[model samples]
Target: MTNVAKARESAVAAETRVEKTVLKVLDRLHALNARLVALHGEIKAAQPVSSGSVCLELYPCGPGCAGCPHPRWVKYTWTVETPQKPSVLLSINLDAKERDPVLTLARSTPHYEKTAELIREAKSILLERKKILASIRSLRNSARL
Candidate 1:
């Protein structure tokens, strides 16, 4: 074959390889986006009911220490009620607590709010991934490879 023909063949082969590689990347990106969506769903499922508001209160250190000089330790709790079972009480002591006089952050176990934020973040990522996949498909189609 002429040198010009051989160069054209090499260019075509290179273009096809590029297209295939891009298609694989697009597939993987699409798969990851799907996984992210599924993860977001799972996180949302762990969300607690909005009705069960958490309560925080201070309890006495002891009867002897009615006027305790030290700062009061707060208790955090929430109740879940269902017809099928007795009411359930859930509580957790926050880790890495700041010794500020007012520890309002520990007042609630609002996992739903945090999980909702995560769901939003994951959905945004999934949206961007889908956009990238669309752009890749557009490029592949435009290139006619």
Candidate 2:
């Protein structure tokens, strides 16, 4: 093969390699974005109290007057209402020192950190790919001359 032909082949091979590398980097970025989206869903689900708790409606009558016109013994009903505010409920039987499991899980998960690092790396890779592609285009133009 002629020297010029070999040089052209080598340049084309290099450009192909760069394109493949850029595509791989973009695929990795896409995977990272999916992971971030999943993590966001988990974070939202782990939030305290997705639904409300049960409430009691109490009716009090005259003290110690079981036979009074207003009977001391009263009947009450339980109802469920959505919590308008944030509050944590602890069972009477559980130890007060128990830690929150949801919080612990969220804090320990590496998804957030990994997502941030992936975003930075993806941005850098994209920028580098753009530059390399421009160079490849220039080479093709020159080859046409």
Pairs of residues at least 3 apart in sequence or in different chains that clash in candidate 1 = none
Q: Which stretches of candidate 2 lie over 4 Å from their true place?
A: 49-145
Model 2 Cα lDDT, one tens digit per residue, 1-145: 9999999999999999988986885575455444544444443343333222111111345685221121011111233445775444432211133432222223344454443343334335434545554664676679874
Residue by residue across 34-124, what tens digits does model 1's lDDT show? 5664654455354443433222223346664312212122224456667887765554432225332123332356564555455445546
User: Ten-residue segment with the worst summed lDDT in candidate 1?
Assistant: 66-75
Error of 2 at 109 (Å): 16
TM-score of 1: 0.43
**Candidate 1 wrong stretches, greater than 4 Å:** 49-107, 112-117, 120-124, 137-145
Error of 1 at 71 (Å): 47
What RMSD value applies to candidate 1?
Answer: 19.7
Q: How many clashing pairs per prediction, in order? A: 0, 0
